[model samples]
Target: MAYSDIQKTEFNRVTENLIEITWTYVNLLEEFPRLDEQDSMSWKQMFVAWANEFEELYGHTNWIESEKTYPEAVEEFAKEKILQWAGIRKYICVGKHIEGITLNPYEWLLEKGQDVKLFESEAEAKIYLKTNGYTDEDMEFLKFEEVWH
Candidate 1:
């Protein structure tokens, strides 16, 4: 069901505050001066999308994690999941997807030697897709533009 207008407003406010605080903590750890605003915004968007996917996959049941260290282990597990998902999804691509039963072009691009690759530029991603047999019409997906840009 769709959220009501009030719910949307509240959610937007809450998400904004939560993300800003999280970014502040991240910056404290990174200790880099003057990080790019665009980069933080991109990360915030990607994290939100990943969180939604995570909830869909594992939020229905209150399944307790099996770790001896209690909450710290759970925290570690969550952090690892986010890092892995970011590595996979935080890149420009034509028609990107994160998971699959079998490895395929849409799932992750591979170089000529079959090692996985992430596109550094939109042009590079487009060229890679075409070289791998994606046609002009197929290139219309532009996954990053819709989701991350």
Candidate 2:
């Protein structure tokens, strides 16, 4: 049987995240069918096997690890997840200068500061401030265009 829409979407999402975070390669269409036929498996089963195969083939290291002593590996994966999401979302941070210090908008918001926010789009930021108790006189919008090096 051919892969369903949901299966295809999920396979794509998982593989894309894996590729972005781990730089691993997995060709879904070619590999999925082969794996499924070889094992007589469903899409979900095939997907899990595919992921495990990637980890085995590409996620190996010489160092030994355990749950108690190697928490950093998990931490590193979480960090990479955050970075991958950030890269995909392309969020722009809105922060006010405070005490001559500038912080990331996300950090400022997390600290309960009212002057900073994060938004995926400039229009959303303007709309949020307009609706959330900020008057025209109380707020000034600053746009920082990103420059890629």
Candidate 3:
């Protein structure tokens, strides 16, 4: 359905309602594949991509959550799901920011024999890895990129 055919009021109202319902359903489900952890990355990526597509089609922004507290069910579900998605091993998210906010906690990384570092920019992070002679395979799990840049 093209927006051109719909009345402005009707279009705006329906877009708002649909966005709310979509997010509610995603939050409620929390984890995809219903207890199957092996398929998490593919599932989450597909789900997020679908939501992103919907937002584009409707000409609305699906706001990224700042943070949220989850009930026991959702929390447990995410914990297990993430473990499986990341191969039940150590991984790190390197963000280039002066504030030094990490995607994963220090305790979690240390427990898995992993090291996490935050640089002022992606270039710095890559240079550090190269300087340390960390081959691409060795640094395969460390991702550095400007998501929107």
Q: lDDT winner among the candidates?
A: 1
Across residues 22-108, which tens digit of lDDT does each residue of candidate 3 receive? 454455345343435435567556445544444454333333432432233233334444444434432333533323345553221
TM-score of 3: 0.25
Which residue pairs show collisions in model 1? Answer: none
Q: What digit string (tens of lDDT, one per residue) describes model 1 on residues 1-149? A: 65554443356433543454355436433533333333667766755664455445444434464334333433443444444444423355444545532344455455679755566677887787788798877666446431211
Alpha carbon lDDT at 21, candidate 3: 38
Superposed model 1: Cα runs more than 4 Å off: 1-38, 63-74, 81-149
Measured by TM-score, how close is model 2 to the native structure? 0.28
Q: Rank the candidates by TM-score, best first.
A: 1, 2, 3
Return whichever of 1 and 3 wins on lDDT: 1
lDDT of model number 1: 0.49
Best by TM-score: 1
Candidate scoring better on TM-score of 1 and 2: 1
Question: Tens digit of lDDT per residue, candidate 2, span 1-149?
Answer: 65563444355534643443332212222422332243323434534454555455435443365443223443344333333433323455544555434463412333266644466666776677679786766456344222111
For all candidates, what are the clash counts? 0, 0, 0
